[model samples]
Target: MDIFDTLDDTAIEEEALMYDYLNQSARKEKIVRPRVDHFKEWDSAEFHRRLRLITESVEYLLFLVKDETETKTQRNQYISPMLQLLITLRFSATGKFLCLYL
Candidate 1:
């Protein structure tokens, strides 16, 4: 049997459509005031600062390139690892790609 077969709308009054018009719910309205989020810049700046300090601590940069290797998979060349690291940090910190710009 279909569920609609047992249903009836004849007893439903027009006022039923507007039952909440006169009565307010127990749930209250919440208004959020957004202030200048200074913490965002502080986080990004701090990350950059920390990254710079860490990099500076290392006197020399090291590379692990194979002397005779010449195959494929040059993905790192297209996207700099350092830049991807920064982007990853920002993305991870914000939990969103668009939120970083905001």
Candidate 2:
């Protein structure tokens, strides 16, 4: 009965219609998209080198942050030690949450 409720219903109906259209097109055309391997691109030597460079850059950034945090904590009387959390992308790829405290 409310305007917001009507807007929500319209959005949900649009999503359902879009999915139904997609299913019908897939059945009619039988189109199959080529499979993609995200890791396959990382198999090359150049990709390895690039990955190494990225890793070093990230490590350097971590080091800078850690050093600055330690320096600030040492001078502050009420501040506590820094807490570092290292979370990877693997869990995010699967729509999961993972917290790793280091």
Candidate 3:
């Protein structure tokens, strides 16, 4: 005569079904965020102006950080190291970042 014995099978099944429904709805609501294609859009001078780093220097930094910043997953992977580095540099240099909307 414990609490576990008092609970019915129907209650457990209902709770499980509720959780499954919530999970399904959440998966459906998943949003794909837009990313700025800065590398392709910006030229060498723009890189220098925004990040205060030359194009070659940024590429070198990307090389330095590639091992540590790389994500192992192929599906829904994190941003590239170069982009991460560029964002950091941009924030440090200009103290400005554009808002990302969902």
Candidate 4:
């Protein structure tokens, strides 16, 4: 199974919450959706909320990874594989965001 598929239900829930928060923040801050004639006014709190959500999400992911990686047979094997997976996932996610932004 894919690394993402290994994420438990709690992780999925947190990820969903993070996405929702980010989307809401983007909508309010007009970062993703520009303020057109019919668009809503910008709100600074939305930006803060988005930042909070992102911070929390990162913490959650780190915790999950740490907890799983602690039982490794050797540090080398665990870290390298984990790092590679994390890097791949990070790049994929970043690429998607870049596409959306562009």
Where in model 2 is the C-alpha error above 4 Å? 1-7, 28-102
Worst 10 residues of 4 by lDDT: 33-42
- What candidate 1 gets wrong by more than 4 Å, as runs, is 1-11, 22-25, 35-89, 92-102
Off by over 4 Å in 4: 28-102
Best by lDDT: 3
Q: Which 10 consecutive residues of model 3 have the lowest summed lDDT?
A: 93-102
Using lDDT as the measure, name the better of candidate 1 and candidate 3: 3
Report, for every candidate in turn, its global Cα lDDT versus the true structure: 0.44, 0.46, 0.80, 0.49
Per-model TM against the reference: 0.26, 0.21, 0.67, 0.26
Question: How well does candidate 1 match the true structure in TM-score terms?
Answer: 0.26
lDDT of 1 by residue, 1-102 (tens): 987576577534445655665555645786645434322434545645434433322212212222223335654344333444444544655665444332
Question: What is the number of backbone collisions in each predicted candidate, taken in the order shown?
Answer: 0, 0, 0, 0
> Which candidate ranks first by TM-score, i.e. highest?
3
Q: Which residue pairs show collisions in model 1?
A: none
What's the lDDT of the predicted structure labeled candidate 3? Answer: 0.80
Colliding residue pairs in candidate 2? none
Give a tens-digit lDDT track for model 3, residues 21-98: 988888855687877788878888766777888888888988888999888884674687778888888788878775
Residue-level lDDT tens digits of model 2 in 1-102: 766666777798898999999888888654555433333434455433433334444356456666554543443243321223122233333344442425
Which lDDT tens digits does candidate 4 get at residues 51-102? 3234345446656676655554753334433343344444555543222322
